[model samples]
Target: MSNLDSQTAYWDTAATTKTFTHPLHAPWLDDVNRHAAILDYGCGYGRTMEALAQQGFDNLSGVDTSPGMITQARALHPTMRFAVLDTPPTLARPDASILFAVLTCIPSNHAQKRLIAELSRVLKPGGTLYLSDLLIQDDERNRDRYARFAEHHDAYGVFETGDGAVCRHHPSDWFPSLLADFENIDTRRITVATMNGHESAGIQILARRPSQAQVGPVDSFTAGLEDR
Candidate 1:
């Protein structure tokens, strides 16, 4: 678990150098309390956090593995709490954690699963989990990269960008199964611009952790993470 993630170094060095434009719809979080405990686990420069703050939502916090990102986030929004994660996938928030396109930065299968498991642990039953991430595109360039890296990477959608960061775009069926631990409230497919300014397929998932009475231990879902 201590193994360094490939994206971390790239992000930290280029922290103030990039801009993220992934869409985060405010209406999706309309049901959540304005003061509910909200977390953005891989928040970049605190864009989503600021957006929620503008919506009259307070009590929001963000954590990221990149010190540069945390620094930039803190500078951008001094009122909001931001932290640098030393041992990632190990969030201390003990409700209603949220993520915005975080999975796209984590290219490996196991790393992504571990982060999801940690999210399940921190989130309270019935808490909202809003996730936005990349999706596989039908374009020839993307398909070629998927095939080119298939032999080395775990997922076909995993590919390297010209700027040298490894990124993952999920298969359509992969998300529903991966997030089986959560009850689906809504899911939407949208077109979004990547940080590099390319239009790509994206997804936004609004879900809730099942009630305690309706499910088994969070560890059970984590066990399946390992089995995969």
Candidate 2:
């Protein structure tokens, strides 16, 4: 997409309106380190980056595929680094990253896997990855509804959307296996009431890369926990 169109879709007023409706802002802010190098993956309009700055994080950077979005972010946060990323990113190997509502926009499972691998690569040992995205539920009705939404959207590589909302859905069980290369720290579901008065469900996952000291042969129980 051209820079202008991308900005319209991701950095416009509507996008800002949609973002604040979610609960990710406060929690993510609480979790990020103020002094560590941080990346706002899929940072639309740089809102989260701004929020991070407000929290006293100076070593912040943002990456988005849309040049328009990047432009808006750079203009708004002049001191912060903003870059256009078409594929796998190669910015600073950060101590942490905030990936709020980003993975769901990836079109396929393979793409998700690739992105996770890239995240692992870009993070330092013992670094943290915080991710939030729409999640598949065990309820048959919810599962059916989610599947229909995915089908209707024709979501297929870098971008996906449904019913005027762009997103991809993943099961709650997906993260453990997908992030097995990292040490699983925690996982939970969060229910958000959107501004339009609709309730949506998503998963919040926090994981850390194994520290250098913890990389040796694992105990049986620890190894089993790794599978959990």
Find the candidate with the highest lDDT and give its number.
1
Predicted candidate 1 versus true structure: per-residue lDDT over 1-228, tens digit per residue:
433353677887667877787666767766667777676777768887787788887777777778888888889888888888778888665334556777777777787778877777666666667787889989998899999987787669888888888778898788888788888888888888878877888888877778772432221111011000
Q: Residue 76: error of model 1 in Å?
A: 1.2
Clashing pairs in 2: 104-168, 161-166
lDDT of 2 by residue, 1-228 (tens): 232223334434443344433334355446555677777767766776676677787876677765666676677678878777664533343334567666655545665676676666656666777776766545565456566655554532122233344445565667788888887777677885532454667677777767662432211111000000
Query: Total clashes, candidate 1?
Result: 0
Residue pair clashes in candidate 1: none
Candidate 2: segments with Cα more than 4 A from true spot: 1-33, 89-96, 137-166, 193-197, 213-228
Question: Total backbone clashes of model 2?
Answer: 2
lDDT of each: 0.71, 0.56
The local distance difference test score of model 2 is: 0.56
Per-candidate TM-score against the hidden true structure: 0.89, 0.69
